[model samples]
Target: MTRKLLHTALVLSLFLPGCRLENLSADQLDLITNSVSSTFKAARPISDEEEYYVGRAVAAKILTSYRLVNNRKLTDYVNLVGQAVAIHSEKPFTFGGYHFAILDSGEINAFACPGGIIFITRGMLDAVSNEDELAAVLAHEVGHINHRDGIGAISQARWTEALTTIGSQAAKTYGSKDVAKLVGLFEGSIDDVFKTLVVNGYGRSQEHAADLASLNYLAATGYDPHALKTFLDRLVARSGGSQGGIMKTHPATRDRVDNVAANMPEQKSDAAHFSERSRRFASILGK
Candidate 1:
């Protein structure tokens, strides 16, 4: 009986990779796949050097289509806020001292590349009426950077020699059509430049982890933990049955807000940290 079971298990392992049985239960297969995938990343601090290179090699293509805001003061302001939050992150990352930029757009969006490069859109910045919401948003992006989600996303997408140049960075050219095509596919909506920056939204669990991390970052910086939930709530409201493909990549805003709220640390009056309706972060895009 034991010998027969061993043979069966080996055969199943061999058959599973390309298994295509339309009548098979989707639920059972998903559970099995997720469980198997978990083992490869069962622990924290996903470390793969190749993932970093692939992401770094693709960074320029992602940013090329974005319209940038050249406001020096506003740019500095966002960096200052982002830097403060990044230091407190579990990854505590400082990729070449991480560069941050503000992109000019009205659609809410932000993305972090390998090597600590992060971009925030004018739309998201305009939507945030105060410091707390901005901080919450930035922290969540940092969580992805620190966790190497960029690397994880790329691992699934093979980096062909056609994309990479003779060597690495120095030889690479991002203007290639193939790279942009890949980006279009990943982002899922080629409607606008912002649409091309589709970040691989983590699973529901990863988003929750980002929320918890953002809450901590906010709390450490003397901001209210509830601010995270507040910002996410605003996201849900603004999306209003249409997130324009951006929200489609991220987890449910409502469920995420609830999770962040549950994990918040109790505190006294949040008046000092609360900055709602303050109209702090502004944009040239706003009419």
Candidate 2:
């Protein structure tokens, strides 16, 4: 699918709230019709390119609520660590490549957009003590992308209906009314993913699988797998009966801590590497 189609979907969802399609100029209608017609197809397994486009749309929806951090150095550092862990995952490359960004919110959360864009919140970064912990977090997010959890969050029924609508509408004339319907469907699919990410959260099994994946990636990349346990322990200790952000979105921290502890691999610590990475982490994001 084209970026133009993705952009048009986002623009229409955000700007056209209740406006009737008839109010638009002929040019605008043509743009909408053409964009929609170019994008969708009969429901099937989503392609990598389509996954990348969907991820971008979800990321755009997320940015509407949270501002991205503007610090280039910090952003670059995060990408460095993220890429380090991402390379070891099952699906190392995506159609759009991997990107990492920090969000300027103090919500203890991280979101993995469908393809490879990962957003770690300022609060989550603060919660991490060093590079290993940060790597642990990024690895966990990469696991979600590897597993296609974000794309899986979309409702199958809704997606099928959306594709069917496009297929049926494509045969005849693609009119403004058809465009509006498809746009609404597209917006609904986005909402399904958005709600799963921000509101309802992934299921326990998905979180468990991601945690296991994170441990594997961390060990493969030379970060202590137990770093994930340490981070989860901190979350458990600080939860204080609260339910918000990560605490709300992920499986219970206590359960995750136990799982990590149970499955943690045996690895020798490299003092020199740890010291160097810790120092670098502190340089960018103070202790």
Candidate achieving the largest TM-score: 2
TM, every model: 0.64, 0.78
> For residues 4-107, what per-residue lDDT tens digits would candidate 1 score against the true structure?
34433333344344434343365534433333233223223434453354445555666676777888988888898899888887766554556678877776
Model 2 weakest lDDT span, ten residues long: 35-44
In candidate 2, which residue pairs clash? none
Candidate 2 local lDDT, 1-287, one digit each (tens): 55654555554554455545456666775756564553444245778998899899999999999999999999999999999999999998999999999999999999999999999999989989999999999999899999999888774756667656655643344467776776677567778888888898998889888999999999999998888998898888988989899989885567778888898989876889999999999999977
CA lDDT of each prediction against the hidden true structure: 0.61, 0.83
RMSD of 2: 8.8
As a TM-score, model 1 comes out at 0.64
RMSD of 1: 12.8
**Whose lDDT is greatest here?**
2
Which residue ranges in model 2 land beyond 4 Å of their true spot? 1-42, 155-183
Model 1, total clashes: 1
